[model samples]
Target: MRFTRRKSTLWRTFESRYYVMTLLTPLGLLGLIGILVLIIIYIIRPNFQQKVVSSTYVWKLSLKYRKKRLPTSKLRDLLLIICQILVLASCAFIIAKPACIVKSTETNSETVIIIDSSASMLMSSNGKTRFERAVEAAGTKAGEVLDGGGEVTVITAGPKAEYLCEKETKENKESVLREIKGLWNDNQNDIKCTYGSDDIDGAMTLCADTVADNPKANVFIYTDATYVNGSVPEGVNVIDVKGEEESNAAIINATVTQDQNNYVFSADVIRYGTENTPLSLKASFYGVNDKSGENGKLTFELKDIPVVANETYRITFRKDVEYTDEDKLRGYKLVEESKLVLCKLVADTDVTTDEEYGVYSFEQVMFDIAESDAFDFDNHYFIYGGKKEKLKVLYVTTPIDKNGKGEENPFVPAALSIAKNYFSSRLDIEVDTVMSDKQYLLTGYNMYIFEGLKPDSMPVDGVTFLINPPKGDYKEYGFDLGLEITSKGSEGDTLSSNSSNKLLDGLKAEDITVSKATSLKNFTGSDDSPYNYESLLELNGSTVAIARNCKENQTVVMSFSTHYSNIAYGHIAVLMTNIIDYYFPATVSGTKLEVGGKIEINARGASVIARESGFTQEEFTLTEFPATLVLTRPGQYVISQTTYFGQDLTDTIYVSIPQSESALTEERYSLENPFTERDDSDYFNDLLVYLAAALVALLFVEWWLHSRESM
Candidate 1:
């Protein structure tokens, strides 16, 4: 009468057979589903009681079979049930196991990719930067996260932790992907750095804090493994781009110590991995003699070390090179086979005197760590053991600095006087009335001054003291023409005819000679301005100076001549001594730090690094050693030291401890066992899920029919 048949009769539930026959317990969800099915069927097809009667005796005869209606109805039901079973069975054969795949209502996640943009990542891996590989990997992870309803944040590392993107969405996938794909790998040249401190630790730590309120964030660190381990923050997941299966050979360390006679060529060659790699190690030195003759000389051969995975190879110069002024000032050189040499200069007092060596220093006299409690500790024994047991000083005539046209600049005097007057007691102060000749900072003092140089030619290392970078230095590149003075000569050198004096054409100083001063700064009469000659460090002029941390823990710098005024000179000794003292981080308790030890240095007050293994503090004078104590060894060591700020201000370092195995001197390591995986997919649930989808469709249809009837 309805002109239609029950489509339910033909509909099939593909996985019903297994659900009914399987010996496994029905899942709780399935039980609930069964209950729902019963309710739906009862509601959709409820039968009412019926009364049937014959109109007359004849009618009763015709309706004789009416008494069997109940049985007939029951029989009909049995047939329908049987037909349904057959249909479901047939469907089950076609689609064996069905599953009820449901959408998860859980929280979406966020991923932060911190790529290592440091120059070190420039090394080629399959012709691409390890940085590129890291970005690719991060992108992949980002895709997964996006697919899962999550977001991505990109952070980069170099001189600064570069935030390339913040919380990009799937909707912006094209732009985000393009941005990353277009990125070029940045190399770690150890040059082109804008800041003295490449605070990767601080960068990541900031990122972690940025996402602190976001519980869904996971930070991925993509790097070449340059950071000292302990410095890693706890909250973020580190995704080291240098894969666990990393095979790398590097010149990790090199040392060169010399004066005017000996030129030493020393190096530390290292190969590390889970597998062995062939390494051709050679050491060579290249320099120009006084005659300007090219001298490419000497080679130190290293015995091939057949090392196991995660091992190192070390080779030192058997014969130390003769000491030369250049060697101490220029630093050491590390040469890799088939690669250019990476060199670092050392300072060992090039300008020597009967009383003491020339010492120049710069001070961060106003620093934030002036309130640390670790100053009283005894962990400075390392400083006491070396040739640096006592402070050294150099004495010279007046007027520490000058400007072009032989005028006094306020900047130089202020910079030098600050370190000399305030930090005198703890330092081996040196005073040089005039600048010297020689390219090295070690030639005369533990520090050098750069107040007079062109601002644009700022050295890669060294503290720059000023409101502006020098004329030729990067700060003022186009404004004036200033030549980058090579480290070869001192401040008093005569200006070369070929040199451009336009940078200093209008420059003049009270006590300096014009010919001797070719560097200058211009000012527009701003009372509080640093470049303004008035009120500049009590000298009514501008000055320049530098302080840097270099080889074997030395911070060599230069102080421009304008800083040599009597207003500054009287305090030079104290400033110099204090700066030198500041170089030695004040001692904390526990004088001797043991190998594989935890030495906490609580730095209180202003401090800066001086020559090798030295640190000075206004309130405390002690030394702070580099991470791992010995660069040769590998281990987890923490310099739990901190400034008073309770910000983990101390350098927390975890050195990768050396294994005799690294030297391939002990025993070789072999893989003890193969890897295995455990599987956990629910084969039953998968089938059930598919079946549930069909059931859901059927349920919707039945509910619609019931609602129509109710209306």
Candidate 2:
């Protein structure tokens, strides 16, 4: 496209003519008027006036001579006059610097350049990333098109197709180059190169749509050709700018295991090149001292290990650093300080050798260590060195047989014991059985399990479970038990079809035989009542099980006794386990997280600080429980939290990069006319120069013709 638009209205009016000329200056018009005046005066005025009265007699004869001679001689004079007029007109036209607006039959085609800016493009070689090179190549092509009198459109293929510049001409070429330079800088610094994948196909589709109306349009794609395959659009070209391949070693996997007092760290390394290289596996441990101070760094290195090309090698390291009394005290302080048992693996090498074909190479590949629970290791583990605390559960039951033999309901306690064993590996649960008549304080327990007994007053703290309580008007405790007894046949009432509740996960009501059950009709604690209660199990419009939250305490009420129902013992055991685990979930120290993945945590009023390998730290405050956190980088992240109880919690999470991105090999795709040249230079200036020269030649010819006629 031309940079400037013609004065179209005036030019179009003169379309009937081959060429149209317009004066740029008013002086040119004045020159034309002066020439017209001279020509008129020369023709109309007499050169001389003599005594014509004396020749009156001869005047008739003179008229006869003048009439015949003037007709023949006037033709020569007219030729001279015409030549003079021609010279003047040509001079005036040249002074006006007239620009002829010639309509062309052929239209310039459009050119679209698409560049990839995905994460894979960020792989650098020779001090430049693939993205930088792609941008440069695209910019060069755009410049060529703009110079050839064609329009250019630049698109960046990122997570989405982004238009950098659209429908730009040679006049806007500088602006287009400036935008491309910005992308180059951003890619170099890895500032906004956050796109994980490329959308080249989508970008190409967009380009096709952009040029749908123009048959002569062409599309160029500049990328590493990592994601290019299959069919391409007509008139589309792909430029594969992939660089030479370099040898690289990446940590494919990592894990930690405990053996007695020793902690073992294992990692799998893979080499992607054809040459063997010497590799180093470095492990760094950040331990906490008793005073919550830095306990000095512990580094273990496996150096000069022979790593074969195109092979996977496993390396393992174990250490048994004993934890003294001071270490245990420091473990407690570590929790308060939000310090985690941090461990990191970094793969490196000392070899400075270069490959013959590679443009650039990396000497280090930091391994992302997988995170494990603090208790997964032995007691001497960094954060779990101290003696672990057990959850205290108080079980209160009334005597079922009050005839001198003081025996309590054994089914409920047996279920509780079974549930306790299920979670023994995660956390220790201590169950203390107490008779209903025994005086016991509820403050010391983490959970209270009541069997066939109603407390005088509900505990305002901790989790409580009530089973088959007698009828009572416990208005003070926000519950009024009903005295109605409902009996079912040998077959129990069918479980609600809506059994999506977590409490009824494995237990099915159809399998149970409930001979008798109490209906919770008088238990009025819901939205319509003074208390809040959520019905868990409902049969015939009556609630058989309900849950209530009073202040910070959780209470679950069941209307039937486990002894009366012939429900599977395993099902009852699982129900009991689900109830305890639901109320007081196990503390999760850390988890294995992938890059660009999200992790949800349920610790209210806690601070989450994540620290990466390069000392990059990010802090987030969760005002409520179940906050979502996204891991963006691949490395070890120490996630520390401070609970509402002034207790510090620490967890370690590892974010790993995808395997596809780790293979730093460039792929090739077929391209048509990848290196086609462009014609972008405008011809208006050259045309103007030739026009000026032609006008000068015409003026010379007019002068020569007038002189010859005068002679």
The numbered model that scores best in TM-score is 2
Residues 264-346, candidate 1: write the lDDT tens digits: 33344445444564444543332212111232222333333344444333343322334356434533233335332233322
Off by over 4 Å in 1: 1-109, 116-124, 144-150, 157-159, 185-213, 217-246, 274-279, 287-711
Q: Mind giving the per-residue lDDT tens digits that candidate 2 earns over 299-362?
A: 5554545556666666554332334575444321111132113222222223676311110111
TM-score of every candidate: 0.30, 0.59
The alpha-carbon lDDT assigned to residue 385 of candidate 1 equals: 12
Q: lDDT of each model, Cα atoms only? A: 0.39, 0.59
Clashes of each: 125, 8
Q: Judged by lDDT, which candidate is best? A: 2
Give the per-residue Cα lDDT of candidate 1 at 3.
Answer: 79
Weakest ten-residue segment in model 1 by summed lDDT: 362-371
Candidate 2 steric clashes: 8
